[model samples]
Target chain A: MEKTQIEELVAKYNEGVADPKEIKWIEQLIESGEIDLTQLRELSGLDEQIQKMEVLSPSLNLDDRFYAALANEEKQIKKGTSFSMPSLSFLLPRLAMAAALILSGFGVGYFLQSPAQKSEVSELSQEVNDLKEMMMLSLLEKESATQRLKAVSLTSEMSQASEKVTNALFVALNQDDNVNVRLAALEALKPYVGKSSVRMKLIESIEAQYSPLVQIALAELMVSIHEKKSVNALRQLLENESMPKEVKTKISESIDVLI
Target chain B: MEALSDNALMMKVKEDDLGKMSLLFDRYKRPLYGFFYGLNKEQELSEDLVQNTFLRILKYRHLFHGEGDFRAWMFHIARNVNNDHHRKKRVKATEDLDNWQERIGHHENQSNEMQHNEEHNMLSMAMDRLPEDKREVLLLSKFEEKKYSEIGEVLGCTEGAVKVKVFRALQELKVIYKQLEKSH
Candidate 1:
């Protein structure tokens, strides 16, 4: 066979569509020294080499990011830009779980608080709540920012917040480096603002916050909650020479409303 | 029982069972990552492209006709997403393949591992120089193991065209790889 014929045969052989006759011809050529088998072998090995290349894994949060994105899209689908209370259908299952946990806690509390045991039922109940709070705090301390956000969001699912949960939120608000996590902590703390301690913390956080967005958000929250005590904090914030004009204005107006 | 196919899972996604997307994601993320990683060799950007691909999949889930191969449709979307990213960062995306070693050199330990795989490294650099279309065709066919029919669907060409492309791409790749090998 000529060189052109050998090249044609090699191409066919590499394409994996060579006939038995063509295969025989290639074998005959290799025997007769018309074509180098090594070259043809290398040509055929390209695909196999590519396949042998290692597959790369994306970061660990790929799934978490996907689910978070999916949930976000689903929420947008179910409720446009409008404000709608979380539907009872959605809340029922979570509510039932919380209720079941509380009932079981009560049962254990009752069993442990008999006459011989001499432990107060309230103390046992408080201990259960404390355990739940400890779990929340531990979750918040996770390395993943998503886990910390999840921990903050879980506070809203609790039947009620303990002092520890509220304190954890305050700590997250003032210290979390990620703006989104801190913002999530703020949103989670919204329902608890009626508490005097929460109100005091929100007022005090005004001075501690470095993020203009969080400071503005805290000021607005304090004003909305009608915490008269925040007037001093707002006034003190107004005294900071480097305060942005926009936030300073917001604080002054909030102070006017409070006074 | 056999698990649900990609098309079936995607059909479920189209019908508002969005949770089924997780199943689809689990099945396809690695392949998608492989495709993007092959294109740019940047892990973070590749991961971002994968995310953008899935997000587009959801955003345009309504457009799925439930007719063709779902994986093909996905790669089609992925190609579009990558093209969009390229257009947005065309100037910055022109980094040469030689920089790959320097980029990965930051880890220090992987330097030894990379030296041990010189052929793989050279092959990758050679692959990086192929025209994007040929490169993608080769990747989808050789790496992802898609059939000519699926590659055609993804590339919007005929199976015959894809077959011709695969042959031509392999020939071109061999020529390029030899040059790179000699230079190395």
Candidate 2:
């Protein structure tokens, strides 16, 4: 048979579409050993070869490696750093460059202490803080809750706090959708509590928080700081009969102490 | 209850429900590993390719359109990962028959088994000798049991092209197998 005829026959045979006469012809061709059955036999033999393939088991920790990569990716996505930071290893070089820039700036400032240059040095130093604040603010505005939480953590590395940082943390605490992130934002704001705005916002957010855990955390923070202004919020929490009994008791104790 | 389909799971992945990736991985990792192994006959490289395939899926999940079979999209990524790996390493698909047998754990202790082992090794090495494109078509069609249409999707070709390629590849594979057998 011609090559096309054989291919047509083989395709039909494999698909089980060959008629009885065609099947008999294929059988006779194979039995006569005139038509090579290498392709057909090889196709059938693959099932056995596949069965015999050494059953390769990858490293036992393959899943662990995959999951670790996944988790690391999740961390990056949450931090809004997925595009910027491909891996933890990439951070080191960028950080070194930042450090070198800072050191060079200080070195330049130290040598150029003339009065006009001194003013320039102070402005440059202020620019660095402004840049840091700008980064924190942008990170805080990211949509990923994990990224927002990372922003909260990144604040701890800041050389100095600013009102903008305080405001961003307050927004995260009062309005973030994710409970853990909101709690993280509250934690970030704890050190800035000396700010009367932070104190007032923390007090005001008590009524806005629906999570009993946040309410309890707020009540504890208010009681610990002895913020006498939280008295009415605690009183309001007490009136809400749906409050978890534990939270109600905590709020009651907070109200008594505040009074 | 019917489990969520692969396309649904992939759609969830695209939507950033990344944890759903674990389910897809559980379903596909073995077959993917086998496909790579069939091409390269190397365990470490095949596993690395599998890992890379999954990583690429995660990195590019947004590109998935959720229209056709999820397996087709995934294998498309897998083929790309394998091609990239092959390019970087300059790994020719061909391996010597003895090396293939040894890697596959052929032994001379049993004469009967040795005969069978030699035939299996010849077939594998013959497969390895096929040009990469033909070998890929053959592996997808014969070993992976993917339909020509699905293979076309994975290979970025039309179904008719895949059918022609499968037929021509099988013919070439048969020639190679005959030569290997004759030499043996």
Candidate 3:
């Protein structure tokens, strides 16, 4: 196509008139350089010139600044500073642990003094008070992780930095043995779950979380995306009558809400 | 992390290396300024946005995690800074029109040949005519040196879809240029 001919095709495409065949021809010509649409290239260059005139022509290059920024960022890393990870929350109650030791020290003195919370303790333990505490801890941890994840999408500048955090989280999510830990990691990852690369990995882990609780969580997340294609994927599980009832129920509910 | 990456610089900034942070600021200040100047044609505001982008970069340095493509990330930040400034100031529609006359006047005395470069002026005038999203895609792809696929990733579209948008954008340019030619 000549310059004007290519321009005409573009014009038609712009007007929504060019058929697929004409579009293909235009693409092929531009790609192969069969027709010298030098005029069009020059036109493209005009935008480039104005851009250069505005943005690039003014500054020194970016290399030195990047190096300086890196130097500052890495100082602590180079200093061999090691951050101690916080102690895990699943430890036994400290007061009970203390009381057992203190039982030997003197008369059997109870830990003291809140009679009201104490009265309800017997009933609560039978309801598995420890498990409730653990669940509460998990919920707190989930909230904390969620807050951390939110900073990722909060600004465009942090994109590269966020990706790094995502990479680290992915490794933790995949390899961590504790289902609760993995669940926490998944919650931290929920905001970034839409990226195809991340979504695929999340999908792969759904089956491995054989616990019904985890499956329900994953199923709800699975169909939450606005994309219909994701809903269809969950619908596949819904169609499988032999699939676990809990997973199907979760997916079916999500599909209903999403669709 | 690669030595030259923004993540590496962010690490340095975290270490309290003011000198490195300064260099990074200096490095980005111009391109960032140019980015704003391309749109607003106001050097002072461009400089202010450039400085503010660096300040925000520094403020958020501790938040750094290594990621792909730092330059694009920085540009995204700069883009937001410009928008934020626009929001705070609220340039009225007529003010932008006034700007066109003043901005065009900056080069009015140039040779006839330079004036005849309809392609150059047409782009700005055409982009000014476009909806905001269309103009954004063109600027990012053409001026920022971002690949079409990368632009799609940034804009949340497929590369093929971005290609379609670019085609329309250029057609808009041609039509506006033709109209200008007719008016003369």
Give the alpha carbon lDDT tens digit for every residue of A1-259 in model 3: 4777777876675566778788678656655544333335534554555455433333333344544545655664556666765555634566567887887554433555368866677656545644433343344334455543333222222322245456655554555555565566677678776688878877766545545565567767776655444565556556666678766776778778777
Q: Which of 1 and 2 is the better model by TM-score?
A: 1
Model 2: per-residue Cα lDDT at residue B132 = 83
- Total backbone collisions for each predicted model: 0, 1, 18
- Report lDDT (Cα) of residue A73, candidate 2: 79
Tens digits of per-residue lDDT for model 1, A11-109 = 888776789788667656654556553456665588678778777788877778888999998887677546768999999999999999999998997
Provide the lowest-lDDT 10-residue window in model 3 chain B.
Answer: B109-118
- Superior candidate under lDDT, 1 versus 3: 1
**Candidate 2: which stretches are off by over 4 Å?**
A1-55, A78-259, B90-120, B142-144
Q: Cα lDDT of all candidates, in order?
A: 0.80, 0.77, 0.59
Q: lDDT tens digits, residues B44-138, model 1?
A: 67889999999999988989988998988999999999999988665553656566665556446443534453446887777878988888888
Which is the leading candidate under TM-score? 1
Candidate number achieving the greatest DockQ relative to the actual structure: 1
For the second chain, the TM-scores of the candidates in order are 0.82, 0.79, 0.68
Per-residue lDDT of candidate 3, residues B1-184 (tens digit): 5445565676776666656666566556666665665566554456567766776776676665556445666766777888898786555544566667654565453333233433456545555666666667667775456476666656667666666666556656666767877876
The superposed Cα distance between candidate 2 and the true structure at residue A167, in angstroms, equals: 30
The TM-score ranking, best first, is: 1, 2, 3
The TM-score measured for candidate 1 stands at: 0.48
Candidate order by lDDT, decreasing, is 1, 2, 3
